[model samples]
Target chain A: MKTTETPAPPPAEPGASVSEVAAPVAGPPRRKKEGAVLNVFSHGVLVIWAIMVVTPLLWAVMTSFKDDSSIFGSPWALPDRLHFGNWARAWTEANMSGYFLNTVLVVGGSLIGTLVLGSMAAYVLARFDFPGNRFIYYLFIGGMSFPIMLALVPLFYVVNNMGLLNTIHGLILVYIAYSLPFTVFFLTAFFRTLPTSVAEAAFVDGASHTRTFFQIMLPMAKPGLISVGIFNFLGQWNQYMLPTVLNTDPDKKVLTQGLVQLAVSQGYKGDWSGLFAGLVMAMLPVLGAYIIFQRQVVQGLTAGALK
Target chain B: MQHGKYRFIVGFLAVPLGLYALFVVWPFIQSIYYSFTDWTGLSPEFKMVGFDNYKRMLHDDIFWKSLQHSLLFALVLPIVTISLALFFAFMINVGGRRRRGGPAITGVRGSSFYKIVYFFPQVLSIAIVALLFQFAYNPDSGAINSFLRGIGLGHVQPLWLGDPSLALWCVMAVLVWSTTGFFVVLFSAGMASIPGELYEAALIDGASRATTFFRITLPLLWDTVQSGWVYMGILALGAESFAVVQIMTTGPGGPDYSTTVLVLYVYQKAFRDGQAAYATTIGVALLVVTLAFAAIVMRLGRRERLEF
Candidate 1:
């Protein structure tokens, strides 16, 4: 893969000194002009990309509100009027509501389970000296690098053999299990960074290990939890591959899987508008959550990679 | 403090470890073993077939095709996505001209807005993004073709996901669109930590924009970039490719398995064709490719650390 490193542009003329220390008042007019051009070029490129990223999303939202004819006929046109009917139909008839509920139940159960189990494990791995600690820590973090699809084939059967297939709790358990890798990996590092004094003091104050964790350490680890929490929240919420394989029951499908199913079925039923509505409906919650929690979301997602 | 230390460790470790071992680790081991079996996945009874599945895979045309496509995804996606992200990130974090009373290095105007808007696609599920782009790529009445027509380029219309020749590119483009923002944000964070004094020094030496970037930004950001490459490459090979190819391409994998990736092929083989053993064989190959990809990138990217 070519990294595409460009040859550096020739250096500025030696005699033309425009460094801030050398010339505070004004750069050479030529330098000013060059800066103006580069500024426009950079901003222009950034703007175009921003547009490319936003346009399809806005199009999906617009198409969701349009009639079938308008949607098929004019791909770029705005809907003549807002069609609340599409949203209502999608919510009630297309089973978007059911899908949303399933997603919430699955993500909620899995997120809470992941954080509790993951942080508990991470705290111990970070703090205590114990036999097999290093081995166990590597074991959890090892899941972070391996391709999950490799495990998923047998995992499908594993879940099925346990009579857990196509069940909400089953999917929740699988989500938590899979999520533990990253959550543990991230929170382990995070837990290590935290001050050990308070937890030790809590332990000395006649608190049990569990009590210290629940009260002093857990609260102190709030920032780390929020970071990894948002990470798992988005991941479990948007999860498609896991549910697609394990939870095939129509009633149990999560939002992402449900939306794809709707698209497939809606194609034949000529419910394009409703499909788009469902798409938008499914898209809104995460996007909204992201916008509101933008900073944390970025931090949460990037934290693993940065480490 | 030491009274029940073992108990505390076991109590905390047991549940998560139990769940992970049962679901993640055990299945991983089982899949490797299953790769050698003659199990149909449809039936419980089966005998060890040794490397029969692996032997079949060597001759299997679709397996080869999927591997080729998967390799292509792993190679090309990271290059394109990382380049775009690095460019956007540089513009956002370091490409701006110095403004009055501002630090020597600063992002262009509205960089934060661009970062936010660019990240919109990353927040949405890949399946949802794939579905959106599938419509956009529709050859007949899709946004792309109609947009071409609007621009008076009606004579030139390409069947995006439908045309096998262009189908893979279309899917790759969707991935690039969805993922570039993530790396942009990631590299931005990397760049944010870089000291402004480096840029100031470069400027003092009469370094051009390109010079400062190649000399200062890229070297310092090398570690993040290397890791990001591996991360993106894995995504391209694994779940991300599965969603986009499965959801977007019709034929499901496309005009004639042109877009069939290893993950999709694995899903289809075990789930659709009942070739569970063979599916695991392919899964094993995928795991190998993934590891090899990570290892090679890391090896190639290893360089003397540029301490700030």
Candidate 2:
């Protein structure tokens, strides 16, 4: 058996697990338990859970707006009045704005690069019955199984040798590179599900494979692309370890590392409210993006879970 | 056309394959090499003092302590996270009876709303979650203590992340809080596709919710649960869980390193101590443990086959 046959623990035939359970139950009516008690119980459990999940986040937002010392006096109280100064101080003095811009640039570049290159490779691997196709496919997927930090020191060496460390573009390239395995794995599965006749027909009609992929095929694979795109966006935006290791330049640090440093500094200085503001700043973009594309983010991320 | 196909594959594969090789594959290969030698990671000159670092690792008390922590997480986090996730997922997906009264399975009235809120943490950065929890777990004025006081349980309030005895448990609780909703959504989706007839059959057979969950839902979704187990195990083993430790704890991973974990040890060794080679040795040990844990889990999963 190939070493690659050792299943990467990250993505269990997630599709099978999630998809099988999520299989549309739109068919015939069956005699089932008429338990109103169960329904009410389910609702109650779900409500409590939702509150448990949301309360901390809401509290963080509330705390970010309160006076730093006042928070100690009234821990659970809603802010007496919204102190918007924390946000300004966090952005201007604590340097969250810089981190935010750095994150946006890196994540943006990484997303586009990953989508284009990942989909290209995924299309070929999924479509062509070529020699070494399985080998290449496994090579990409195998990246996911191994612990990532094991490679950090050597990766630092390589990135340094290439003179890419401490640069936003450097971070972008690394993010894009690391993201490929999952993107390729996901999109390959997605592409294989697309009807082949369309691509075959496009080829017959004088379109090159690239054009077919770009025009006839990519458009068809839009749902998959959007799903994986959002997945990469979230993953890259929240990255902490890589930036911490590779980018020592404070100006280029991502929001995650910035917040940790800010929090640590504030922990010593006792600027609790401003620290909360930094956490909020680091949070809002991804949270805002998620709220807008919650379905796609959820669906795209959980793609393997269902199949 | 044959040459054209080759050309096309080459064109598509070139950039991604190159980047993967240069960044991921080569670094992985080189890290193994680095693990073997005594290199400070700064100079070009270094000696291959084979097995010396590995020898040191065998004696490091903190390393062993952190490994114990990793094992505890591997064992405990999965139990708590999976149980809650499964129970809640089952509740959301299959607990609801038909509104009109029958065995027709439907999700609770606001399952979608419940799902979105439950899944809110999955989107936020772990750093943010950890920081948020840092505030929540503040021994003096944090939400947890405040609530405890409000509930008239002021005497029982723990220092949470501050108290050395309770520190690791608080971290685990936070980890569970952040990740449980994700599995809930996952299991919900898994349960969604299960035929309502199965539940009806279980109901007709006089199975209780717990019994039906074990016999019908669980047996059917064992594969999903197994995968979830492996994923949880892997996460528990890795440094990702240390985001909270990195944020909330003092002394890098303290109350006197009470919450210290293996990956955090590796990070400290490489970056803080500048003992890069020794750090790589520890990384290798981590790799071995993670792979072994995954293998063991996979084998156990294959052993229990409820083939219907």
Candidate 3:
């Protein structure tokens, strides 16, 4: 329960000047010749690793633009003609438009469900002193360790019995179940970090628990909620197995499963240009979201993992 | 006030608790029951088979081999992936601290480029990765063997996903590449949590960079390490080995069951072969294994929480 206190800030603009931060601390100055050599060496290694990491993605992008002839003949070259139509064909032919819509609905449904329910559960666990509270918390933690695949068969049966198969609702329910563990774990930790005084003061002023949670607590837990939402979104968006098993109808298929079906059906015919294009398009939202919220996601992941 | 508190707790707990019970607890109970009974998926008439399936599984060579392969894959993947990830994280974390004249090359600021690169494969679906590797490993038009031939190492270019001996290893390499970035991100975050003051203190004490890392950083990040291990291990166990196997080998287990894992085996048995009871039994067994391993790791790794 011990929380680390933030240090006093040197200035309001924390990220503005590294020099200012370094200036206050008396430290050994870098040796001239040695620093130069190490600097060059470090940059050299980083550049090499960067190239290694970026190469395949660059290859995919380039390949997507390549004409069928150039794909094999000049495998590594820039396309002679930028075939933007490949993307258009992928969108139309691969039925990616439908798949994209399915993914959006599934991801959106799961994110909203997990965040709302998870935060409520977390609020109770963090702020309450009730019978079986600790035990209930552990139960949720145990859910984290439960492999969804183990429950795959029974889950399929249950979904079928509910007549929810091949529907967006069915996929959302499965995602909510699968995501509860991690989301609860994260939001619980985050809720604990919130000072209880605010909620208590609100309660003293006659605000109902629900009112306090929604108006005060939930708003305060925005970062945690966003982190959980992003995690759930990525997971749901990229998800393959649950949808594949529970929803086999092509119209109901999410992007991952849809792309898989497309690849399998057309891969051998050397028509994978569309598959690669679809793959690239599917990767866009995730990459864009990650880039925008890179800081939050990185911090959230680390904190969650360490906890 | 007391009554209000109780009401609050009940209200807050209702939704998640109900969902967990229905989706998780109920299904879990049903699975254990189904494992005991001889229930074909299509037929509701199933007798209480007792432990017959478990007994049969005792001598089942494919089940045993699949389990062995799963265990081996689980064992090796975590070690390899975590090691590589830790190395990269450490390099990025410490290497950034050294004052470089030209640019901030080795730190988080510069390392963002690497982050995007490493995480690229994660964005690609496993299916896409499987298909890509399929073409990449194609002997005739494969980029891998072609590169080897071009480099005068053609003899060393074994059929990556074709040869039974090399298929598992090739699959493992792809898994490693796909996942290493996730671990790198995890490890970097762990390293980030260790206050710069600790490193400064260690440096002031005349500790070398390596010594500080081993003594301060590694010990401090044990929780993250444990978390990464458990997460990766569970994923490695549950993931479909069949994706790559199906794409590369053209069969269930590929090149004589070398790449077969338990999930794929269950998939084939139940869906492909229509042995619902057998598949459910295998699923039950995998459940037990996963739970047992998780329990052991959690128990062993338990320590008093570290205050940063």
Q: Give the lDDT of residue A251 in candidate 1.
A: 90
Ranking by TM-score: 1, 2, 3
lDDT of 2 by residue, A282-306 (tens): 7776778778888787887777656
Pick the DockQ winner.
1
Write candidate 3's Cα lDDT for B29-56 as tens digits.
7877777877777766888899988888
- Candidate 2 displacement at residue B160 in angstroms: 1.8
Chain B TM per candidate, please? 0.98, 0.95, 0.87
Off by over 4 Å in 1: A1-25, B304-308
Q: Estimate each model's TM-score.
A: 0.95, 0.91, 0.87
- Could you tell me the fnat of model 1? 0.76
User: How high is the lDDT of residue B28 in model 2?
Assistant: 85
DockQ of each: 0.49, 0.36, 0.28
Query: In lDDT terms, how accurate is model 3?
Result: 0.73
- Compute the lDDT of residue B185 as modeled in candidate 2: 82
- Please tell me which model should have the higher DockQ, number 2 or number 3: 2
- Candidate 3 residue B65 Cα shift, in angstroms, is 1.8
Candidate 3 regions exceeding 4 Å error are A1-48, A268-270, B100-109, B154-156, B195-208, B240-249, B295-308
Score residue B195 of candidate 3 by CA lDDT.
79
